[model samples]
Target: MYEKELEAILPRCFEMYDFMAEHVEQLQHLEAMPELKLRMAFQSGILSFEHGLSSLKLIADGFTSSGFALMRPQYESLLCGFWLMYADTEAWFNKLSTAGKVSPDEIKKLETPLIGVMLKDLEKSNAPAHILRQLNDFRGINNSAFNSFTHSGLAALVSNGVGYEPKVIYDSLRNCNAVAAINMQMLSILTGYEEAMEPVRKMHHHFVDCLPIIHG
Candidate 1:
């Protein structure tokens, strides 16, 4: 029912969440300051989001690259990644909506309902409904954060560009950073108990341990 490697990895996720939060707070403070600080905060905020997104993708790729081996590898990484992507995209959509640049139809076109997407995938894969429900709950939390950031109404602050005051930018960045942090936390939970992950983790490690040589 559990895996050891996942246990080893769970703490790392928590650490990442805390680390991301510190940056989010810093960005928040910087947003209220002068242009110089604002630019820096925005850059940091953007970089953080990018990093968070990359991390999610990497974790997902780890699941997909192992030839879909159920024992040696689990697709939980991909599952979690989908959840995060769903959250991030929803946030962007909300932000655009708050800015009055997008209509409800436009928002609908975006992947706002990530939980449903994952559930659909699970159903297709014939995975356990109970587990899928748990994943859905996690996705819901991330999606909520996305909504919060977008709903906070940071569009005007962004439209003003780099000239905006640090304080305003910082506040906006706080929302951005919070979403990123939440994504990291979700990843941690998914990967928290390596024993839960079982042979899948070992299989993944084995693949990494063995790399095929390429000749030009």
Candidate 2:
């Protein structure tokens, strides 16, 4: 049922793969951030790029649910990465110390602020105003669908157990790339270096074809 769609979309998918690969290559030599906590958060957010790219590949192969499944889990980490940076860095570590060291199970028990609250704190932290504002507005609009995708909710469960439409997958890939572009910009912010940041500032302008239509 999906062969023709795959034929049409596969080339675009490969182009995105190459773009992300180039990004991975581009980010390879970044020096660690001065503080360990900030460095960890930065790395966690960086992870979203590869994760998003992988899900794009899965979607291109006609695995819609699997691709949808990955969207939120990693993206949440990206959000949390920001939270750790601005919202609750010391409190989190203090909690971690109660466990004598980092324990995965204990970490899970720790409370994370909701997305809205985190964004508020990020804004207060003086994160880039434009990015912070867009993140807030975008979450307001799409959080439900994103949450559904992560938790196997109705949106991830399509009718008749069939693959998603090719256009849907194509559009999904574009949106994912848009998020990746944001991720790139965030990474550049982390670097605090113009050389690492210059190209990222023009990512969308250069690669608009494979990215979603974004204004701002």
Q: What CA root-mean-square deviation does each model show from the true structure?
A: 19.7, 3.3
TM-score of 2: 0.81
Give per-residue CA lDDT, model 2, range 1-216, as digits (tens): 555654665676577557656755666567447777777677867688768877877766667788867766556666777777666567767775677565777667566666777777787785767767666765765688777777777877762176466666666666666667777766666665668776765566666676766567
Top candidate, metric lDDT:
2
lDDT per model vs. reference: 0.38, 0.68
For model 1, the superposed segments whose C-alpha errors exceed 4 Å read: 1-162, 194-216
Relative to the unseen true structure, what is the C-alpha lDDT of residue 112 in candidate 1, on a scale of 0 to 100? 31
lDDT for model 2, please.
0.68
Which ten residues in a row are the worst by lDDT in model 1?
64-73
